[model samples]
Target: MNKHLIVVTAALLMAALAACPACLAQTAPKRSAPEERQEQKDARAARITERIELVIARFDNNKERHVAAYNAAKARLKEAITELAEKGYDVTRLTADLQAWDGMFVKFAQDYATLINLLRTAEQYAPYESQGQFAAAIQQARAQLVTVRQDALDIRHYYQTVIRPDLQALKDQNPSSSPASSGT
Candidate 1:
């Protein structure tokens, strides 16, 4: 009877290990596989966000740097909304305001990406190309910067005005929801 119990326990352990590949490792992981994976994802996101923020902070009074900063800001916006999008939440469908904001964000991203590419290509070809061409490219880049700045401002305003109110309302609805454990 004892031998039968031992064999049964060993079989269950093997099955558990097989089911969870991480359990097969020589050393036990501090977190379960899912938790570890989540942590890794969070770390990656943090790194990307930090990189974007660094670009923003280091932006100088130059067209190239400004374009880089705007591009980085676009990346930050994309990353900020990725989890919400991945969760299959239709934020744009929730309200007219949300839909407008979503459209603005998308348009801003597209414009920034195009502008960044144009600026980079111009810079690359500037030395081999004519001065007039380079100057015209700079003028084009500077002209686009105004709209890009406005897009960023609009995004910031939308987040502060619309999203915060909705979030506060949600928090108010849930009495037992603690801010510390919100995992936000």
Candidate 2:
């Protein structure tokens, strides 16, 4: 009689389990292909956002170091110019060149700021919904990065070709007043 009761209970449990699929099918709706595609796009956008954040952090660190180096070099150049002037040396050309390079450096800094702002804007865009706007921001940021890099190279070139040579000429004329090189 106990085995007969167990067999009846097991049959009832099997019958209930067989009915669960039809119950679940009605309770939970199936996702269509478009919904699945949208989910995939949203996931991709989230991953891209994370990567952009990491890039921003690295870029900021490098930018701070670059700016600090620029300021230090500018100070050194000014000190050297003052020392030369005090020693009865004509620093008119060196002063002019320094001013020009300073202007270029200022523009370079502005471009870097613009690039960072564009990346920040890109970060603010919504996943999947603002894809076009996000792409545009990224493209603009890439272009700005190119501009900033070119600006840096131009500043280095101008310093090497114009200012360094002028300073070298001054040092050649007076071997005693050896000013430190601008390590830009």
Top TM-score model: 2
- Model 2 per-residue lDDT tens digits across residues 85-153: 767677878888888989988998899989989998998886558758878888899999999889989
Put down candidate 1 lDDT per residue, 91-119, tens digits, no spaces.
33224444566677677767776666546
Candidate 1 to native Cα RMSD, angstroms: 26.6
Q: Which ten residues in a row have the lowest lDDT in candidate 2?
A: 175-184
TM-score of each: 0.38, 0.80
Model 1: weakest 10-residue lDDT segment is 175-184
Count of backbone collisions in candidate 2: 0
TM-score of 2: 0.80
Superposed on all Cα atoms, the candidates' RMSDs to the truth, in angstroms, are 26.6, 4.6
Q: Which lDDT value does model 1 have at 81?
A: 45
Question: How many clashes would you count in candidate 1?
Answer: 0
